[model samples]
Target: MSGFQIGKDIISYVALGDSFTEGLDDPHPDGGNLPQGRYRGWADRFAEHLAGHVGELRYANLAVRGKLLRQIFTEQLPRAVELRPDLVTLCAGGNDILRPGSDPDTLAEAFEAGVDRLRGAGADVVVFTGFDTGFQPVMKHLRGKVATYNMHLRAIADRHGCSVVDLWSMKVLQDRRAWSADRLHLSSEGHRRLALRVCEVLGVPVEGDWSEPWPQVPPLPWREARQEDLQWARQHLVPWIHRRLTGRSSGDGIRPKRPDLEPLG
Candidate 1:
């Protein structure tokens, strides 16, 4: 994708997605989740990268954590189209795939519609395929569904003439350090790496290479690994299940960090 370009005088940009877009684990100040646009995920990072190449870029991130694909389409997509940005980046439908009986084909249909609308509005849209989840524990079971959806996403991108940041091919993300303790979201390093990847997709020059390998580290012993998995189950997995059971969402009252396109500094 080195030759692909959305970098042609992109004056405005909008990002739409869920937790990953929201920067869940990649806190701005390098700590826990903070409010008031502090979660500078890959979108923000990528916007900054663009700002370096262009001038006076207006950026908006209408991505709330835990948002379902349908919710994003009905809720954020309209606002994104309304923003009329020169560029748009979308990565949705992960939460839906996590559900018990979700269908990748159906989800892909909705996703393609959203892409079509954004493209129709004249924005240079960029879509991402979900990361290969085989590295995670229980979540790895959804690999087939994610893979299927990724193929759909690639097809949709081709059909719609949109750029694609294929996260499924980012083999570097398979490392444990790329993920946070919660095991659902990426760490700051992961977000940074993803930012560089998007820069590659858009043909924008950035300071770093995302594919650089991580430094060597000893592997955790079996007992310690097992303990960590148990802790994750107790901490992250259980709450997620409970929220689903109670019809609640992590982003229930959360609003988009940057609802309107604002000029970047």
Candidate 2:
């Protein structure tokens, strides 16, 4: 797609959603006191791109890891509206979809509501479809559910005049290197590519292509694969299950790293 020209008047940008938008697993050594990681995702990268094109830019990221769609709508959406940014990127619903018995239709209804609200506030809204996880051995089962949610997201974006970054269609992400060890979050290179992809959708100029291929690697042995599965279950899956059972979230007491729309330094 060709880059669309953004008006010079557009300045403030706010990002809302969960870990994906929060830039998880893409560590920043100087994350300060933020509960999780630092703010360095596609949102921040987009803001930097905007700043380069338009001079000064104000940006805020209200995303936190482990936030469900409902929580994001109830908590972040209101604040985003209050901020009245010129641009808002919303990438929620993944957390909800991963949960057992979550309904895509129901989730879409809530998601569309937030998009409508952001549009009503006169901000350009951007939404993301969930990635296809069929290649992941443990996450393959959720492919159907993710597909359902992605379908809903596209319809919602169309209805609300919001732009969408179609993650499910990005074949490059099928590479195992695109994902972190937990198979939940994106790796640093993955985040870089994701940023470029978002910029492409937004008609922003980017330095590189997100679809660039990675170096080839040999497949792991069967025994190694099995061992890795056991390790993953022990290190990530079990903890996630525990958190769910105890009614806890990774973002329990975390606050937004950038709560206000200010100059990006």
Indicate which candidate wins on lDDT: 1
Q: Estimate every model's Cα lDDT from 0 to 1.
A: 0.88, 0.85
C-alpha lDDT (0 to 100) for residue 143 of candidate 1: 98
What's the TM-score of every candidate structure? 0.94, 0.94
Candidate 1 per-residue C-alpha lDDT over 89-132 given as tens digits, one digit per residue, 9 for 90 to 100: 89999999999999999999999999989988888888899989
- Candidate 2: 10-residue stretch with minimal lDDT: 1-10
User: Distance (Å) between predicted and true CA of 35, model 2?
Assistant: 7.5
Model 1 stretches with alpha carbons more than 4 Å out: 1-10, 30-37
Worst 10 residues of 1 by lDDT: 1-10
TM-score of candidate 2 relative to the true fold: 0.94
Q: How many residue pairs clash in each candidate?
A: 0, 0
